[model samples]
Target: MLAALATFGTSILSALVPFVNLEVYLGVLATRIGDDAAAALTCAAAAGLGTVVGKLVWYWLAARSMQSQWVAKKLSKESWKRTFDRWHTTLAGRPWLTAAVLLAASIAGVPPLLVMSLVAGALRVRLEVFVPTVAVGRAVRAWLILAGVGAVLT
Candidate 1:
């Protein structure tokens, strides 16, 4: 119970800060808790939930920041607007493709989730689509990490 709560808290904190690596935390937790499947699953779930919540906060902030004069000015630049428009055009008509890209980034951190989350927000992706996709991707990634740690430790 205590470990689960700790995992939840740590995951939330780690997710909010890009410098903190959640996988390393999970591996350390696995080492401490032994190779218990239930514990691993619990930790993974907690981490996933935490990640979703943290990213949502980031998304919200990015969305709101669009109204700021600084952001508006930067976006108004022709070159910047063109680049943004290109991405927006590509993503606007394709929900599934956007979701897939976001999911992949969430899981693998390939494009860096922070940037993706901001972009998704800036693009005004639906929360309905964004939340579930991020949650599932983060969950699977956490589960895989826990499983690998368990395998090595056992």
Candidate 2:
């Protein structure tokens, strides 16, 4: 019980920190908890919840700061402008595509969660859509990682 709570807290912290790799963390957690399927699933769920919470912070901040002077200054840069334009073009007018891309990125880590979170915010993805997609993707990924680690160790 205590370990699960600790894992939840650690997952949140790790998710917030850019340097912490979640897959490795889950692998370690799986090893520590042994082959207890219930415990493994609990930890995976906790990690997924933590990841969504942390990523939501980034998404919110980006959305809020879109109109800020600082963001304006950053966007003024040619490179930044190009990046923003690309993201806007790619994500705009295609809700299903945006969701699919975000889900794939969250589960597979192709474009990286940090990048996707920021892009989603900048592109003004609806929170109602973003939250559930990210949460479900993170949960599935965490479960797969834990299960794979358990299989390898046992």
Candidate 3:
């Protein structure tokens, strides 16, 4: 339980601070836990939950900023409005596609989950879709990393 809490806190820190590197932390954790696959999984779940919660802070900030007058004025420009509208339409119109992309981004970190969280919020993607996709993706990623490290260590 204490380990889980530490992993959760570390994961959140990693999310908020780009240089923290959750993977390295998880690798070290994997070494300590040794061949305890279940423990690895539990830690992964805690980490995943923490990551999403941390990213939600970014999402909330972006969403709130979008409501600001300055942002509204900037978005009022034709080009900016067009871009925003395009993203909004694409994300809102196709929920499954948005979820899939977000999930992939969370797991692969190709487009960067931090950026995706902001994009999702700015575009008003539903939390129902956002939370599960990100949580599952991050959990899967953590599990894979833990498993690989365990394999290598053994």
Candidate 4:
């Protein structure tokens, strides 16, 4: 339980601080735990939930900032507002596509989950959709990484 909490804490830090590198921490943990698959899985679960919680901070911040007078003034440009509108419309129109992209970003880090979180919030993705996709995607990613490390060590 303590280890799981530590994993969760580390994951949250990694989410907030890009240089923290949760993968490196997870790899080190995998080596220490050796073949303890249960422990590795537990850590993965914690990491998944923690990452979502941490990323949610970014989401919330972006969402709130968008409503600010300063942000509204900055976005007063017609071109910028048009771009934002196009993206918002596209995302809103294709919910499944947004979810798929979120999942891919969370797992593969192709688009970078941090950026995606901000984008989702700026575009106003529902919490009901954002949380689950991110959680499941991150969990799968952590599990795969831990499994690979265990396999290599064994």
Q: Specify the highest-lDDT model's number.
A: 4
lDDT of 2 by residue, 1-154 (tens): 7766766777677668988777787888778877888987887778778888889888988898999999999999999999899989988988888889889988998888888998888888998778888878887898888888888998
Q: Write the per-residue lDDT of candidate 1 for residues 1-154, one digit (tens) a residue.
A: 7777887777778768988888888888878777788887887788888888888888988899889998889988999889889879988968898899889988998777878788888889999888888888887898888888778888
lDDT (tens digit, per residue) of candidate 4 on 1-154: 8878998999999988899999998888888778888988898999999999999999999999998997798689888788778768778868898999899999999789998898899988999889999988998898888888988999
* lDDT (CA) per prediction: 0.84, 0.84, 0.89, 0.90
lDDT of 4 at 7: 89
The weakest ten consecutive residues by lDDT in model 2 span 2-11
RMSD of model 4, in Å? Answer: 1.7
Clashes of 1: 0
Candidate 4 similarity to native, TM-score: 0.91
| Predicted candidate 3 versus true structure: per-residue lDDT over 1-154, tens digit per residue | 7778898999899888889999998889889888898898899899889999988988888888898998899898999899888778777878899999899988999779998898898987889998889888998999888899999999
Point to the candidate with the largest TM-score. Answer: 1
By TM-score: ranked, best first: 1, 4, 3, 2
